[model samples]
Target: MNEIVKTSAFIGAQPYSPDEFEAAIRAVGAERYHDKHPFHKMLHGGQLNKEQVRAWALNRYCYQEAVPRKDAAFMSRVHDRELRREWIHRIHDHDGLGEEGGGIERWLVLTDALGFSREYVTSRRGALPATKFAVEAYVRFVVEQPLVIAVASSLTELFAPAIHRERIAGMLANYDFVDDRVMAYFKRRLAQAPRDSEFALNYIKTNALTRAEQEGCIAAVRFKCDVLWAQLDALHYAYVTPGLVPPGAYRPGQATE
Candidate 1:
């Protein structure tokens, strides 16, 4: 657990080789990713009810809607045309262009299947306060942090496909309400996350040239894991555990269209 919890895993007197650095980054996810969260365990193990699942999907829309804006914020601070060119596609992948559609649209498809009106999902007035805070904190992070560290924060995608696969299988098999159409967001991300993480990982490996920079990058990933884990913590608290659905936030069986 020390390897997982220690903040200084890569902040030693000497910097790690690219391979060691990559290993340390993956270690953060192995230990800290939301895949390990209790809420996700319940989610993927067929333990949550339809109301709880609806709450998860509804709150997640807040995060899903923010991704492209986060990428846009990152790209705004970047001066390198090549970097911006490579990164712009991230926004496209989320926001879509023309009629290609994108992750956000697919996510709304999920909410639609779950019976939420697009306006309700898009308004985000029903998301838990903590969820909105965590999502915006991430957006502000990519906006304020060093570009490489900001890029590194995205390395969480490296560990995403596993959870996506688990979600696709688990939700489909367990929930009559969940089907291939409802899982379209995660299925699409199976392709996009790998592509995006590859670029972000390469950028981090190449650009984080010093021990401090490398450690900072690693910490950024840790921060991102916290961000993701924190959102689930809030969801579990509001919808699973204590079961206080905070005023103005989403509650299961409320007005779903």
Candidate 2:
């Protein structure tokens, strides 16, 4: 017991005030979030062709689909009833409640507008390998890491509402195929993201009580950012620049190129 306390003291050395800690967490998103990625710029700027847009939607389906699984993993590890109750909404938000519907369904609405069959998108059989790896890594992180760090990883939501706003407005303004219906996912997220991010931010700020814990939480945000950025990197590599589209992955002209 004495040794545990001594180790904890060492790990928590020079812990920040709550305000300072919150600032530090936000700084991580400012620096590392995927909004900085060029793919997003092209996506929002209407630089991508229909094919490129299709690829983005198809690949992104993997992430949207995985969100609920990661939340479930987090809930599985939580012992607190209140925490579980609070966190379970995240899953329902993605998975939907009965007839009410959900984020995943809305995302598919976007993809359906782009002309994907539900079978192809949900199968995830054509996603960039990196997309699969990154999404799985996120779920695994929540399952394996300390509960607070896993929750902190979700703090990327802190920066998401802005991007969703950009997506809704930019896609509608720029793309001929885009409409309020296709943009429903981002439109819904505009309200939902702020609500969800607030809970995650407060949870981390309150529970990441030690310096090491705080830094780990911040790094988790960076990790999620990397996960997001890497998907774009893979997309750019396979679809945009050299246009090498991986052997089994979707290319603009066909299901796989």
Considering every candidate listed, which one attains the maximal lDDT?
Answer: 1
Residue by residue across 1-257, what tens digits does model 2's lDDT show? 01112335445388788889889889988998888899999999999998999999999999999999999999999899999998888888899998968999999998889888888889898899989999999999888888888888898888999888888888889899889998988887888888888998888888878887887787788888988999999999988998888877886777531
Candidate 2 TM-score, true structure as reference: 0.94
Off by over 4 Å in 1: 1-12
RMSD of 2: 3.5
lDDT of 1 by residue, 79-108 (tens): 999999999999889999999898999999
Cα deviation at 242, candidate 2, in Å, is 1.5
